[model samples]
Target: MAPAITTLAAAPELSAANTGFMLICSALVMLMTPALAFFYGGMVRVKSTLNMLMMSFISLGIVTILWVLYGFSLAFGADSGSIIGWSSDYVGLSGIGVTELWDGYTIPVYVFAVFQLMFAILTPALISGALADRVKFTAWALFIALWVTVVYFPVAHWVWGSGGWLFEMGVIDFAGGTAVHINAGAAALGVILVIGKRVGFKKDPMRPHSLPLVMLGAGLLWFGWFGFNAGSWLGNDDGVGAVMFVNTQVATAAAMLAWLAYEKIRHGSFTTLGAASGAVAGLVAITPAGGSVSPLGAIAVGAIAGLVCAMAVGLKYKFGYDDSLDVIGVHLVGGVIGSLLVGFFATGGVQSDAKGLFYGGGLEQLGKQAIGVFAVLAYSLVASAILALIIDKTMGMRVSEDDEVSGIDQVEHAETAYDFSGAGGGASSRSTAAPAPAVTETKKVDA
Candidate 1:
């Protein structure tokens, strides 16, 4: 029997309420994947919009199956020295259906298992934003499978599993500040480096094709994030409720103001793109510290994330890497800001016993947070790079230039997102609707 099982058997009263609450939280978290689809779908060129949506939506299917098969076992199974999980509990999900209590909470183990499965589904999909336009669909599907197995599973073990080094070291990641955000962010940077810039990256004025779709995505993400962060508490207690509610408002208001303010100052316009990006940045920043800090801390986290991510998104210009949709800028940068800030803002004055640098706890907490950050970054980057290389060498990761230009919707999926109802011979209608920009005038930085 696993150690957690033994401990759980000793204290059965702690399982029921927690398990029920977590089950609901897990379902809420799952909705974000579709929300992500809409968010990314609207950002790409119209020709590839459907393709982008598929990229995010497909993960829900692929990762869900894998999580049941072996992903969960590798992540939360019995520990093997904190580096990875041993599948001694392989497919032992058979007995998990029993009404058992664990961790001083009474709930079926299956509830916890499914809750975590939603996260596994979303993490790899987040990286898809970085490689949006050029990658082959089959290649991406295969890449995520291998990437999750090699990178995500092990890292998750280190942070959440029993006997994991980070867990034993007292590193606090409240949700997935490092595991999901930073890990995806660094991996995005690595992939974009290996893949090179997208066609017409800096020179093409790649405006979002649909602002409404972007707003739709933002709304879904906001709604689902409550489950993502508060669910970490794994119970329906007052603490979880408070965290969920506060996380909702602080992130929204902060991002809305920050994005508009920055746009007015820099570009003399407040674009919808800025609004969507800022909201996501705030959400990312608040994720790690949501449960541990006060409302004020949440606002600070959101404001800083919005501003820092906005600045970081421009790095693609100077550094010349095409993070197609700013996954690295928003998720990775925001995640780091939140994680580090929590070190100084976790004033236990609110609920927990933890305090931050400004709260008179000194740099001890900050040091620990930094260490956790580095360890996660190093592991994720190296592991993800190897996974990418192996997948590239073994199968290939990109599509042909002709296929890309023709659009993955028609070429890859054998379908199109729209049809002009046979009016004006299709060709004339498309050409007349909007003339393609001349080669010299393409806006690359916004792509």
Candidate 2:
């Protein structure tokens, strides 16, 4: 038989520069998930660290299948209604051949599809942090599959899909303020509500297992976020991409400083965890508003989110919700601050038509921003809670009491996060913070 092959030609008018840039941007965004794995993994107790990392890794697998199957079509296909798109036309990437562009965009359909898929993968992984060390791995996987289907796809349609209601209403989500951070954060809250707290939440130390690893993860995320925020423009030859790139850095740095300042004032010392969390908060806050605002605008937004989220982390105790890793505080609260502030700071130079309230646009954009935030928050909260309830009632969302107390890592995965016994033929310890296997009192080996 003749060799079977397929061919692709660049979109005739495609700016090769943009396509190449976005391909790199897509890879950068993909890296953020693994970076997230490390970030969340390092934050949990040592025993559950591996499981935390796996929670993020699994999203890469599950969401990849769903997106290729029907997720993309439902979110981005030809609009059948203002609420959702028609999957029948583009399921598994059928009907539209690879040669076509993504409508008005310069990138090939395949590139845009994959780039957005990175966002889809990262969003669910963001929720895994809040459920650390408590849920069954199987149940967590199932929750991600269902939550993304019911909440993420439809919300993506509402915000970014052509002819979508929110898109038509002119709510500005340059990247994914509503679709990503807030959506995952609210879902995290809902699941925790259904599943209850990790065994010794408030009383437990629950400190970061590896502050160095956490710092590394934060650094990687900060680096990769350039592509995430600026690439939203989908092109850099335009000056707006540069504006966004600078804004991302400025906002993140400012936020970190603000967070550290808060820590020093309230806790009497700065902590590494606070710095990393502050950086992420800044990134989340800038994501939706970076394109619309100036660098100073970004700094203001980032600083506010850093301060607010630093304080919000304490809400778990006051409200008694037990968000194990503070997902609700940073992502949900940061996303809201960034999205709403655009109404106040959007100066109409680099992005968007309508100016912000501070720029003389009045409350029109502010009202729209609030509506978008509340809409996503409400829908995700309700949908996620229902999904969690179904999973908890069916397969059981949480692990057994013994399993939790014994360490969900080995119970769930039959593996230890950091095995040292293998190096010297010593037995593994089952203690919560298991130390290196001891050297037996053996005579020194004759050398």
Candidate 3:
């Protein structure tokens, strides 16, 4: 009798299906940056429109360069302490092989790195909404570079990295309730506090110049968010990603309706702007909890977020902070609602075995969720404020008062979003504001 030779099992191979899916998802997320530009651009007065678009578009450049150089390493590299991470292999994205898998995942390291890069690029752009009309373009760009390096990278490591303190403590953030929305929202608050209010915060009629543009941008954002939420699951290998997709849609719809309902009761109208903003509020709320909660749970989360965030937007005006575009209202408050609701809505059947309070998991998970929320909030608020103060002291953060009043588009970019010089056969550009009613003589009529 002869003994048969035995061979060891092969290591995991590349997954073409997952790789292709992720590449598509990454492209979708990339679209969100430009979508945000339009969404914000349409909300500001016509004079500041181009500046708003540029604020988001510029991040696509600044963060991409930093990510390739060192941002990726600091965020995903081997843990140096509970606070930060570093690895020689991840520097310049040059040390890794193309085919290497990302920490035993089905996709290649390149695919994962690029997908994550899109996140880094989008996070700081979110803050641009808060600084909309008043900030100098150069200062905003510089702030993006410095803020991401000091605030975003470390916070990302804290929530998602293997050895991060929060991750080690079993705090769950399915996507980026903590890392993306809350972090950016808090930063926006901090920076706005340092720079002071817009030129005419209370007296001006700063109605959106183009509601149609806002609607268009909001539609694009809704489409892109499917990729943002579903793709965070990495793959649909176990049907978790599919569940996330369903929950994402459910929550967003509920939120839009809830917001519209609230607006109708309180303000007497269901506005186009309300619909768009409500949809975004829903998307923000589901970002962190979509994978952990069921579709029904998602409805509760969305409705609550829509109601709460709708109320929160009014707080800035009352508190005297000029959050030009409601970034703090929606992202900051929505992130808090979603992150904490995971404690009560988590089902233990989805992403992990963790259960929420309603599922008989008790208050333990709620306590953990609270820790993650407040920790990120407190750190981001304080750190971002200090950064803004330093930048303001050194070179100034706001544009000149004259430039801001005349229009930041011309002074900063030398271009306007719309050119009306040729309108009505006039060589000079006309103000976008509506003109006074024409005076006419009263005529006798059969009365």
Candidate 4:
């Protein structure tokens, strides 16, 4: 009886590597939140830069606490018919100490919990880009808290958690193709539709305020993505190592070339924004298939992602929807492209268990991939629309026109990013003072 009990208590080693590696992966995943802040922050007008940053930053604090409380249970707890977690064993991380056990790993369950927490933080932040500059901060906060609970958690359970329908069906997401990208993309569309367009979305130039800021954000996102994709392996292995290294170079180069080529062809100049946007497009495209495809396939995925997302961004103009920062375009379209392409480019000649078109596996795998994409899209859109309506009715989602024109940074946060020198040179002068003085200074300098 003693020997049997000891054997039952022993958990398999999660990975072959030591705790140091898992710790690093955890840290890498954590960086993605801040990286996302920079990525989204740079896309909006100057008036709402801080607001964008705040959206991403708040997730780090809020979601981490929620994950500890019951978010993990709802997401990864003992599966409840693959729709949600049933067990509350990890609520408040109870019994999840250094000695706690999980599938194939001897590491503390806390490491797994922390890694997943970062993902939860990022998913809601992804939607914030679509609602930038218009939504009330308090309302946005509450909506995110509720959105994760109602939309994100269940989808996560359905895809990644045990007994999930998609999992049971044997869909190959590899790393959140359906769960994260498709889900976020669909929700972004829903929120934008309900929130309505930003003031002068189509008519106004609405240019990105700082190209440098945009590039910086893109760089951080690219860097942090190493953890986002590679860390999903959750262990140090040859496969994970190769995926991490190749994901970095293939995506960087493919996106850079694709964007520049597109810009040169269409606009006659390769703008910095094009470079940054292309990089992100590549990153999004590779996310779903990075683990399954070869390096050459990765390049194909990234290059196509860049071009497809670039074109998809223009859809808002043609269709008359204001996806403020093109979240639907880059994430949704790129995700679809990646998910489908893997059906053709996957190794083993596409005839084996997971063959792609190029591997002679025919179209069966492609059909399966398409099914996964459509399923996630339909479910996320409807659910997100319902959730948005609920929040709108309960707490109000958008700010008034007056507050919007005054700039969300000031109206919402009561702070401004810049205070021009020599313009408000007098004591007691505030930002509200007329710009006539600054205009005069500018004329004098020009002269």
The lDDT leader among the candidates is 3
Better of 2 and 3 by lDDT: 3
Better of 1 and 2 by TM-score: 2
Q: Per-residue CA lDDT of candidate 2, range 238-330, in tens? A: 698899899999999989999999999999999999999999999999999998998889999999999999999999999999898899999
lDDT of each: 0.81, 0.91, 0.92, 0.80
* Full ranking by lDDT: 3, 2, 1, 4
Better of 3 and 4 by lDDT: 3
Residues 75-174 of candidate 1: C-alpha lDDT, one tens digit per residue: 8878887788865444645545366544345656677788888999899889989887788898888878988888888888888787788877767787
The superposed Cα distance between candidate 4 and the true structure at residue 168, in angstroms, equals 2.1
- Using all chains and alpha carbons, the TM-scores for the candidates as numbered come to 0.89, 0.92, 0.93, 0.89
Model 4 misplaced regions, further than 4 Å? 1-11, 14-18, 349-353, 421-447
**lDDT for residue 368 in candidate 4, whole number 0-100:** 78
RMSD in Å for candidate 3, one decimal?
6.3
Q: List the residue pairs that clash in candidate 3.
A: none
User: CA lDDT of 351 in candidate 2?
Assistant: 79
Tens digits of lDDT, candidate 4, 303-376 = 88888888889999999889888889888888888888878787752112577779777887788788888988
Distance from true location, Cα of 264 in model 3, Å: 0.5
Worst 10 residues of 2 by lDDT: 424-433
